[model samples]
Target: MDIDAWLWWLIGAAVLGIALVITAMPELGMLAVGAVAAASVSGIFGGGAVLQVVVFAVVSTALIAVVRPVAKRQRTQRPQHATGIDALKGRQAVVLERVDGSGGRIKLAGEVWSARALDPGHAFEVGQEVDVVEIEGATAIVM
Candidate 1:
């Protein structure tokens, strides 16, 4: 076969490989491989070499433009809002000590946490059931 035919065959093989990789593990490199394959095929078909380069450039650019926004949107759509003590709000806790206008300790979700009384002068005894009202920094507000 001619060199051009061989180049075209190589391009086809590359495209097939890229498609398989994308099907198995859709990653950014697959887009680059596809663009290279397209450009190689364009070159082997006797299209202007500049045209082949332009085709590759345009394809890669468009793929990046389309994929980035979709990936970003998907990432943003999943919520990762609350963690640790932040997740304790609205849950019941057991006060371990009295919050003497400062802070005390409480047992929540099987873990001990620093807690403060939302209402001043509201004394809590050990094992007293309290509601977790809010979390500020490293402390939880109890009621």
Candidate 2:
């Protein structure tokens, strides 16, 4: 028995989809979508082989060229949620001890942390609220 051109295109789309799942490469999925478009051209429109090939190539290349950059940009953008020490920065902390530039202590995020004032001349008295500016090697710099 002979398979129709559209059936072959669908098979190709299926193989590409399987490869996408195995390799975790999104480009393969894009190619699979292109193959499905080629199948539509062949089965629905009765297009010639050259037209089907052109549709597949154009669709695949367009997806890679247009979608890949956007995906990469989105992936590379800075995350919204901070974790660990990063989450502590920019938060308010209460001075547990007199905090000067050299050293002190503060209640940060329900835990005591070694802290210092951001400015050498500035100091925070005990029971005062301060803003956590940054974390440096087990120390929180406050302002």
Candidate 3:
């Protein structure tokens, strides 16, 4: 068979293998597939050493540009619910345990989290409704 045909087959196989491996191990699969595709395409169509280098560079650049944004978007989407303590401000919560002026625990979205009072002398008892007023570092300030 022609070298071109063999190269195409290799590329196809690499892509298919990537798809399979992605289901079980996505990181390794992505790297293997990208390398295979770049090598196969460059080996087939590149006319000389310089052309091969250029083709590989272009393909690698394109892959980085395309894959990076997609990966970033996926990561952003998964963690979009709430992030830094600032995100908790103004949200309502219930005291999970008694809170003195210092610190205590509260329940937010069915999850118990560390909390502190925003105002001095404020005390919250277990099961009492509280509103998130501010965030100080990793702690939520409740009223």
Instruction: Give per-candidate clash totals.
Output: 0, 0, 0
What TM-score does structure 1 among the candidates reach? 0.52
Better of 1 and 3 by TM-score: 1
How high is each candidate's TM-score? 0.52, 0.88, 0.40
* lDDT of the candidates, in the order given: 0.72, 0.97, 0.70
Q: Write the per-residue lDDT of candidate 1 for residues 10-106, one digit (tens) a residue.
A: 5655775676676754444545554565656565565665665666667657766787789779878856777765677899999887764489999
**Per-residue lDDT tens digits of candidate 2, residues 1-143?**
99999999999999999999999999999999999999999999999999999999999999999999999999999888999989998999999999998999999999999999999899999999999999999999999
Question: What would you estimate as the lDDT of candidate 1?
Answer: 0.72
For residue 57, what is the lDDT in candidate 3?
58
The candidate with the higher TM-score, 2 or 3, is: 2
The whole-model C-alpha lDDT of candidate 3 against the native structure comes to 0.70
RMSD of each: 6.6, 1.7, 7.4
Worst 10 residues of 3 by lDDT: 25-34
Worst 10 residues of 2 by lDDT: 80-89
Sorted on TM-score, best first, the list reads 2, 1, 3
